[model samples]
Target: MQSCELSVIKYILFTFNLVFAISGIGLIVAGALVLSDVGEFDHFMEGRILAPPVVLIVAGCIVFLVASLGCYGAIRESYYMLMAFALCLLIILIIELAVGIAAAVYKNDFQMTMKDLMKSSMQRFENSKGDRTAWNNIQTKLKCCGVEGPTDWPENTRPVTCCHATREGSPPPEAHHCRSAAPQDGILYMDGCFYQLQEKAESASKILIGVGIGIAFVEVIGIILACWLASAIKNKGD
Candidate 1:
């Protein structure tokens, strides 16, 4: 390549590398959060929203390496480098398309989940078949563990009869909180957390996608402009 051509390639490759590197980092960070208890990941993990941990790591690796290749390609003045960068971008684009389609397939699930969430929220207080004292007692008793449970007791929490019938003389197992179906309640809680996490993941995915698409489009447009400019320069030189 001529001097001006080399400079243009350098610039293009640099920009490509920077863009993809950010994309890779964002994906990896999002993935890591999925495995973490740091936020509302339970929402994402519940009801089949869980993304395999390995998949995120692998996606991160692919993005990082592909971006690095572009960076290295520019400095080395190797056409092979540019080809590798192109291939990597293509792979990311394909992966994004696949994942996006998968997300759409799960739309019914998401809708149902949202409905459940809202219904649960409103009905928690409305379903008191008996005096609310039992709920307070259970909350009081549970506080021994130095933690608070969900404020709005779900419907599955045992009815007042269950709590009222329990004799003070015979303590039930630790698993049986007064009027509470802890296991089923746990699943409900997990579902809520999983839902929230999916939202975050989907949002992050969109951002990465938008950035990747913008960069790739620029590269394509740059290629065309470069070619036309070089042709016109050549004619002028003649």
Candidate 2:
């Protein structure tokens, strides 16, 4: 009966490890997607903004490696290996929790940072060709006029990109009018890009927090299973 129970537990552990391994891959993919999305606005962001995705990717790699160890330990009935796996899982759980907490705490500060960066970018828009191109691309793509709104641009100097397209894939009629301090009603985009970009950043941070907390629960279960199996193996030896 003891032997049979041990066999069942071992298989159960193996199955759990398989799921854990796949989750690690999912984490990597999730991180990569977030990173790619944020990369589009890299010109408008600071280095610290990349931390969450990068951390997720690194954590995923570590989890993958640890899960393999768990699988091997379960198959071999190695008490030491199982204990080590539990210890690693504990470490990972702590890390995930820390990241989730930090992300939640820093969210407000992140908004302020983004606002300052956008203002700085706008200030540099004229003298820096790179900034000019980036601003134009963002204005057109986001369908927004400026950091705050159309008036954020210097008087009578709004770019055509700030103007709404007259029809699909066609330029706005009388594009020159966009340069006027005040274009005709509905001729220019009224919203600011800052809020849109802020929303995206916040969404990404939420993803990080969600994933971290969700995966931490899984890791906790794995840790308990590993420790239980390790204890079982020890009892069998006794």
lDDT of each: 0.49, 0.85
Model 1 steric clash pairs = 42-193, 42-194, 43-193, 43-194, 43-195, 44-194, 158-179
With a 3 Å backbone cut-off (N, CA, C), the pairs that clash in candidate 2 are: none
Provide backbone clash counts, one per model: 7, 0
Per-model root-mean-square deviation over C-alphas: 11.0, 1.9
After TM-score superposition, the amount by which residue 59's alpha carbon in candidate 1 deviates from its true location, in angstroms, is 2.0
Question: Model 2, 130: alpha-carbon shift in Å?
Answer: 1.8
- Say which candidate scores most in TM-score: 2
lDDT of 2 by residue, 29-143 (tens): 8899999887688788777777889889999999999999999999999999999999999988888778777867887887778778887888887788888898888887788
Query: For model 1, how does the per-residue alpha-carbon lDDT over 146-197 read when each residue is reduced to its tens digit?
Result: 0122333444453332232135575443434543544343311212222343
Model 1 has a clash total of 7
